[model samples]
Target: MTIRFGLLAFPGVQQLDLTAPYEVFASMDDAEVHLVWKDTSPIVSATKLALQPTTTFAECPPLDVICVPGGVGVNTLLEDADVLSFVRKQAAQARFVTSVCTGSLVLGAAGLLKGKKATTHWNALDFLENFGAVATPGRVVRDGNLFTAGGVTAGIDFGLTIVAALRGREEAEAIQLSLEYAPEPPFHSGLPEKASVEVLGRTRQRLAGSRMARQAIIARLAAARHGAE
Candidate 1:
C-alpha cells in the first residue's frame, strides 16, 4: 500500500517540526509524502527558511496520516477557518492524526483533540485542557488514533511511534537504526520544568504574545461557532 502522508505547512511554520518527520516519512516503505500549504507556491518558516509545498491543502487527497507542525505562525493559523476546516476534514478520513510541538494547539483548535490525551511543547501543555484534552508531559503521547509529541525534535520519536503502530515494532526499530536515532542535548533546559529561571522566563516572553493572540482567536472562533449553531 502506498501510504499517503500529508504534512501541513503554513507561513512561519517550524523547520524541524515539519522536516524531521518528513525525513522519516520519506524513508518509510512505499509511502507518498506531501507538503500541503494554503498556497501552491512557497511557504516561509518562522526561522525565515522558505519551503516549496507539493500540494495545496484543499487539493490534498485523502491521507493515511496527517501531520500538523507548529511555530510562531500557528498564532494566526490556529484561527484560520480555511486551515482548521481543512484539518478537520482531512483528519476525519486519515488513519492517523499527528502533531509536533505546539501543533497540538492547531489540532485542538480544529476540535479533534477533545476528550483525548495529548502532549505538546511543555510550555503549552496547560493550554491543552482548554480543548478538553488530558495534558501529558511525555515526549510522545498516543491516545487511540491521535498522536502528539513534545517540542521540536520530538517529531522524530513521534514518527517512529506511529511507524510502529502502522507497520510493527521491528519496522520502526529498523528505521530508527537507519537514522541513527540518538539524543545528546547540550542543555538540560528543553522542558519548562527542567529549565533555569532565566531560560524559562525568556522562552515564555518570546511566546507570550503569540500565545495571547492565539487565545483571543480561539475565544472568538468558539463564540462564532457556538452562535452559528
Candidate 2:
C-alpha cells in the first residue's frame, strides 16, 4: 500500500525541520509526500528559502502520516484556529501524528499531546507542560500514535524512525545508507549541558525574543483552558 505523508508548509518554517524528513520520506518506496498549507501560494522558509505548497487545506487528501515542522512561524500558528483545526482534523484519522522541533508545540495546541510523552526544541521543552504533555529529553519520542522529535536535525531521525515504524528497521537503515545519514559533528556542544557558557549564552540571546513570545503564547493558552474548565 502506498503511504501518504503530509508535511505542514507554512511561512517561516525552519527549512531543515521540514525538508530533512521530507527528503527521507521521499526516498521510501510507495511514499507519497505533500507540502500542505492553507493555500497554494509560495511561502518563505526560516532561512528565506522559497517553498511552494503542493496542496491546500481544503483540497488535501487524507494522509497516513501528518507531520508538523517547527520554526518561528509556529508562534503565529499557536493562535491560528484554522491551522489548528486542520491539524486536529487530520490527526483524528492519520495513523501517525508527528512533529519535529517546535512542531510538537502545534500538536499540543491542537490538543493531541495532552498526557502524552513528547519533545521539542530544547528551548521549548519545558513549555510542553503547559499543554499537559510529559516533556521528554529524547531526540525522538513516541507516545502511541503521536511522534515528536527534537531540534531541526532531529527531523531526519524522526523520518527514519517513522519509516521504521511503518516499513521496517532494515528498510529505514537502507534509506539511511542511501542518504549517507551518518552524523559526526565537530562540536560536543549540541546539548545545552555540553555547550560552553559563551555558546549557550549567545544562542539564548538570539532566541530570546522568539522564546519569550512562545512563553507568552503558552501562558495565554493555559489561561484560556483554565477558564474554559
Model 1, residue 29: C-alpha shift (Å)? 1.2
Query: All candidates' lDDT scores?
Result: 0.89, 0.96
Candidate 2 clashing pairs? Answer: none
Per-residue accuracy of model 1 over 137-199 as CA lDDT, tens digit each: 888998999999999899999889888888889988889999999888888987777899999
Q: List TM-scores for all candidates, in order.
A: 0.93, 0.99
Candidate 2 is scored at a TM of 0.99
Q: Which stretches in model 1 have alpha-carbon errors above 4 Å?
A: 225-229
Q: What is the model-wide C-alpha lDDT for candidate 2? A: 0.96
Q: Tell me how far the alpha carbon of residue 63 in candidate 1 is from the true structure, in angstroms, after superposition.
A: 0.2
What is the overall TM-score of model 1 with all chains considered together? Answer: 0.93
Q: After superposition, how far is residue 192 of candidate 2 from its true place, in Å?
A: 0.3
What's the alpha carbon RMSD for model 2?
0.7
Candidate 1, residue 122: how far the Cα is off, in Å = 1.4
